[model samples]
Target: MSDAQYTLPKTNSGPWNTRPFHRQWLMRQANNLFDFFEAASLNPKGGFFELDDAGKPLDGANSTRQIHGTTRMVHCAAIGSLIGRPGSGEILDHGMQYIWNQHRDTRRGGYVWSLDNGGVKDGSKQAYGHAFVLLAASSAKLVGHPLADQMLADVTEVINTRFWDASRGAVKDEYTSDWSKLLPYRGQNANMHMTEALMAAFEATGNKDYLTKAEAIAKLIIAEHAASLGYRVAEHFDENWVLDKNYLGNEMFRPAGTTPGHWLEWARLLIQLWVLGEKRLHWLTDAARHLFRAAIDLGWDKVHGGFFYTLDWDNKPVMREKLWWPLAEGIGAASFLTSYDRDDYFQIWYRKLWDFADNHMIDHARGGWLSELKEDLTPTSRLFVGKPDIYHALQACLIPLYPANGSLTKGIIEADHTAKIAH
Candidate 1:
């Protein structure tokens, strides 16, 4: 940790605001992630392919693609297009076309959960997937895709009518296609993402409704629920929106215990939400701080250099495997905290996170990030196979490069605008 590679950033111990080397380093890393995914993610079939650890499409992979998976690639591709990554517009165009043509359930209305070989694999509509749809539409709108307006409008309508529970200040979970039953399950993960998508939508369109909905969700989930639970960011819930402390469903999405990574994610997002709200909102920044602190104190492996995936109520690690996205989220959260408050706390964690990623999570030989590591900091694939998705990793690299006041798209556009005027 004391070596030059992991040393504290900057020429002096002053504020990192003036530092350029780390931002430049972040740009390089961001470009590497974008290149790795862009070169191999496009699946001329419909959506993007799942890339292996070496950044190639997984062999014998089922042509099945989750809607969130497709939408995230589109969202990241829009970021690429905005940043002038070559052939990015094509990626943007390809993804938008796929989502409109294949993912959408034209007869039923909202998007389907998953597709296989261009057909519906799971006709179940999920709030999680639709939130990503809104996110993809918002990012595409930012990049000026031709279908962006129509797609955004359509997804927004679907969300408002099908998913939004105005009474609860959040969205309901899953539904069968044809707009059937609402599953008894309710979860914060979908609402967390909806907060993210809503902010992006607001950024792209200046729609205060989106921002208002986002704030409500944040208040309900973070300010009310997680705050009551000590900022651990509860994952599972019942229909009445009460915490289902014993509920354990899927290992990947709806795991049993609290996911610290999501706390880190919410920490970064709350800052963005507060800034996007023109800093008019109260309690968001403080909540962000608490969430960040809780994740670090409860989740990080003090014996090692990575975060445990999940933890029980007693603050013990439940799923002990180290995951990549948590570290990615941690750095983004750290960058935002560092930017808004002059606290060295976030700046310090930001560097330490990068150190961990550089030494353990990044596959320098393969040109993409390693998906997971054991508690001992060795690479493992039990939980995440391949470089599952680039959204988290890409944002982790790019978020630190720009001001944390708005969504990443806004950060890129405004920063680029400033750069152009400066030159």
Candidate 2:
């Protein structure tokens, strides 16, 4: 194809022209998600409520809130608010207050794990939730939230002092309520999120320390850990940050085998890191390409269309169920690779993944994307109930439209600003 033919048309009306059509589709999806989740999810008492089968917010005893879920809403709302969405600022404020009043441990330093209508449900301090806290604060800062800076500073201190293990080059998993004792188990899952949060922190605060930490984590997880394990990131780990390939922990987060979703996520993040780090580390691009191929080779369902949730050590599908977020990450990773390399395969993968999401994961009648589905593309709530979080899906839509900046928050802001000037 010629250069002009190689480029997609800028017109919005098209079938699968990635340049304009995909970006426009993403904007519509993101706007729809913000509108739906904001209207259908706001809790009467506090943080956003999880929706039920019928898409209504769950109430009473079913209204139990997780810290990660609450923080994800905050992060998404912050992004919406920054992009000029109406009513998102209120949700951002509400989420920040919920984190401060309900989730934070006054006696201790870190945030709690979960909460109910009554009070604290799980008092454990998890690195996963803390990572979201960092992400939420970073995005909130972009929207000029009053408490964002304080929350960012507080969470940064907690992550660095309590969770980060400088010697191991990875963060620890969890801690007790009083922050007295650290958990023996370690996890790259939490660390992966931490890497994401740290990159956002670098963008929000302009702190080189945060960027340095993020680079270290990317090195440890991708280059050191996954490189040795056939580019399949090891989820569970011991106190020394050694991969425990045999560890069978939480079926959802820390599964026994590898999650294809995470490989895609890491690939996208590595690309961002490569660009953000001034392309100093040439190997990050190679690692990202390798990781994306690993995910495609092992996690993709050949018979079916969607990506599998997990794969066993021998590359067999451990969990055949297809979650919405993996496809989201796949779209993002494919977009990033195609943007940088101009690889036709990545573009094809990007179009195919978006088509899969539109066919199955996206809710045509309802506003937001469906959370999970079975192998037959039937909606299933086995692993996830309702739309637990919009972070992944929202990013999937937005990330493709922007360049691979240090973080999504920064990219979105810059893209919005540039669009406004063009208009």
Candidate 3:
């Protein structure tokens, strides 16, 4: 595919003109996900890995060296469900094996954050990691995995013991192996992720408490972190929910401003809650709509095809580079929006996503998607290739469910092409 051939379609002024093409596009995207899962499952590690150009495993030198344990678990569960594969069960079992034998803090209740190549605990306990554990466990249950019940119980016990802050009525961010809360109670990213994970857990187990917590967090976003003027979710906060303006060495929540990525992620969870018929359906819907509109107004790049990485509350661009994750999130939010009655806005985002994926992120010379891109639509990083990791690939897999023109399938092809290029 030549760059000249990759023009982004205009935002729909009225309804979308090509409805049938969109359905076919989604079907093809679903097929691509099936193909991705099939290839990823053949590895002996029983989990996915990031592959180099020669399809060799990336070196495992430190904490960042190995495929993230939580990422592997979520991806395995998602792809497994998408393709109707029993191996997803095996993958979930493999993750549980690591948690039980390697990372389980018996003195505490939750699992450790990272494990070394030998499967020994290598890091402290983190709420973010535990959220993925819940997500994987819940997904396993949805797909008829036999051990799902036991996994659910184990994770539930962990959540109850370590992360749950009973006095505060909210989950804490991280802790020592003995269940001591880390100072500062930072990491809004963990809260955002847990909100999403809780949505999945509520679906899997019919747990009203999980749904209630998820709703509470959504309410928290509106009450505590939301900027009164623009409705953007604030990036960082202390235990009492005081806004922390200082950068303060927290790499996880950086750029010190409102971000499209986090908003998009939050929108995803809110939509999930909306679909699940949570009592606060109208509130959830309004929150998602507000975030979606803010994300587009602030982060979208008009000259280029995709969104900027992050933006401040004033709608000024912060990190102009287009990170891989936001694009995935954008596609997800746009796809979800397409299911609603707002067809014009949906087509705009849908076309923008396709154009961005085609021009910048897609590796036409190779296969699969690139990790990141410059604001000018240039490749900036390469992390994962065909070797499966859940986040981006899962987003790609979900694109087909939304109504779109053939552009969405073309986006899938670009993802495959990027993977091929990396290999």
lDDT of 1 at 259: 94
lDDT digits (tens) for residues 59-154 of candidate 3: 443323222444445445544554445455555556545545555566556676665555545456777777777776676666566656776788
Candidate 3's C-alpha lDDT? 0.60
Best by lDDT: 1
Q: Predicted candidate 1: what Cα RMSD to the true structure?
A: 2.6
Clashing pairs in 1: none
For candidate 1, write residues 269-305 as lDDT tens digits: 9999989888988799999999998998889888886
Q: Residues 33-78, candidate 2, lDDT per residue (tens digit)?
A: 8877886777878887887645688664458889988899999888
TM-score, one value per model: 0.96, 0.94, 0.80
- Each model's lDDT: 0.88, 0.84, 0.60
List the candidate 2 regions with Cα displacement exceeding 4 Å: 1-18, 59-62, 419-423
lDDT, model 1: 0.88
* lDDT for residue 168 in candidate 2, whole number 0-100: 74
Which portions of model 3 show Cα errors greater than 4 Å? 1-21, 30-47, 53-55, 60-75, 85-92, 166-169, 227-229, 248-255, 278-280, 382-388, 399-423
Candidate whose TM-score is highest: 1
